[model samples]
Target: MLTERKHTLILIILLVSLPVFALLHLNSGQIDLGIGTMIDSMFSFNNENMNEVIAREIRIPRMLTALLVGGSLSIGGLLMQTLFRNPLAGPYVLGINSGSSLFVAFTIMTGVTFFQSDLGMIINALIGAFLFGLLILFFAGMVRNQISLLLVGIMLGSFTSAFISILETMSHAEELKVYMLWSLGSLQKVEFHQLGIISLIVFLGLIGALLISKQLNLLVLGEREAKSLGLNIKRIRYLIIGITALLTGVITAFCGPIAFVGLAVPNMVRILFKTQHHIVLITASFLLGAIFVMSVDAILQLLESWMVIPINAITSIIGAPIVVIIVFRRLR
Candidate 1:
């Protein structure tokens, strides 16, 4: 009851802050909009008005993308950690992003223009992320040591990155620039139409993961325990993989491969909440993750005049330290 109450208070705080963050994000770009003006434009405004155009067309989509991407990746990270029983397990850490990058690179290198559409790229990236993710699972079966598995995943990322380098060298200037920009990762590029597709895929994945929360709770207890208690470990593993892949692939496809949002956010939530209950962790992960990414975007807006920062770069720089701290704690 006490833990629930504590989490409930945090949850309420998050519920209230999400919109406040949205409003802040809406007002956070190069040209700032005041709260009164943001409300006026959102509630009642002329269609031809410039503020309305900026608010509706530009800010809203990016804001929504940040929330969706952050929430989706965070939740996906939670599932991956549980499935592998490794504190360091996550979509980015496990080579899911690398897998997606490899396929996305293929699309650019081979000029598979057919898969170049928003939907097509999504499909291509899905295959890549899912395949590499499953490959990690295969390695998980072979190697039980978390450190060994971590090294394997890192090697997988390095291997795919080498392929990407080769592709870039063979490509023309235009293709090289396109791949480079995509690799840099940003939420600003996803338009309203693309946001719609991302929202659908990610939300469905979230729902699917949440529905299996009980199984996740049991799975964390160990495969033998989970099986003794009547949980289908194999089935749950595959389902977790599917949801993680869907969430990671869609976000990577649209926003580029966002590093550390998944790994860092879930670990942060666990530390803050101090519980293994999937029910609490999942909800906390989504809300907290959304706030985390929005906060990063706000910081970027503050530094925009002096620096052109990629969201991925900012995440990696900040997240690496957090992950290292977590590693030390786990070692202890």
Candidate 2:
């Protein structure tokens, strides 16, 4: 009963904060819509005379993208932590982000067409991430040692990164410019339709994650223990990896390999909640991740108004120090 009440409180807090953060996001930008105009535009029942088009078309899509991407990355991170039983495990650990990056680089540089459309870029990225994730899963099945699996994943990431470097070196200046910009990451690029697709994919992934929450909780007790408890360890592992791959792939396809959100937010939630339950951890991580990204976006706009700084630059600037502190504290 207490646990249920606690979760209810958390949910209420998240529900309240989400809209406030969203409103802040809407009001923030180069153009000041003001609170009244922003509210009017949001409802679409009023502010018909104001810049309703800009609010609905531009800021709304961007805010939705932030929410979806942030939530997706956080859930992916939670799954990674459970799968690997490592605090540092994240979407990037299995080379999934690298896979997406490689595909995006190929699209930008070689103009490789998957479906003969710009959406081909996202398709190719999903392919790369899925394949890489499968390879990692295969190796994990073969290896009983956690450290070995970690090393293999790191090596795979390095291999994919080397391939991206090769493509970068061979690409023309124009192609390189496009690739570089994509690598920096931005939530502003998603159109309303694209946001719909992303939201759908993320929603499905989160549902899958929720369904496997019991299995994840078991897996946290160790593979042997999980098996002894009648859990299908192999099948559960594969399912988790596959779902995580899909989530990471889709997000990376659009957001350009957002870093550290997956690694940091789960740990932060664990520290705050002081529980290892997948249900609570997953929900908290999602909400916290959304809050974190929205906060970062808000900071980026504030900083951009003061100086021209890329969103990626601001994220790295803020994320790196926090990571370092976490590492230092862990060492002590």
Q: Each candidate: how many clashes?
A: 0, 0
| Model 1 misplaced stretches (Cα beyond 4 Å) | 35-50
Cα-based lDDT at residue 245, candidate 2: 75
User: Worst ten-residue run, lDDT, model 1?
Assistant: 33-42
20-130, model 2: which lDDT tens digit per residue? 998788767778767666566667534346466666667778788888777888898789878878776677655778877877788888865563254786687777777
Clashes of 1: 0
Candidate 1 on 206-319: residue-level lDDT in tens?
Answer: 889889999999998999999999999889988998888899999888888899999999988898989989988999899989998998998888788889788888889978
Worst 10 residues of 2 by lDDT: 44-53
Instruction: List the RMSD of every prediction in angstroms.
Output: 1.9, 3.0
Model 1: C-alpha RMSD to truth? 1.9
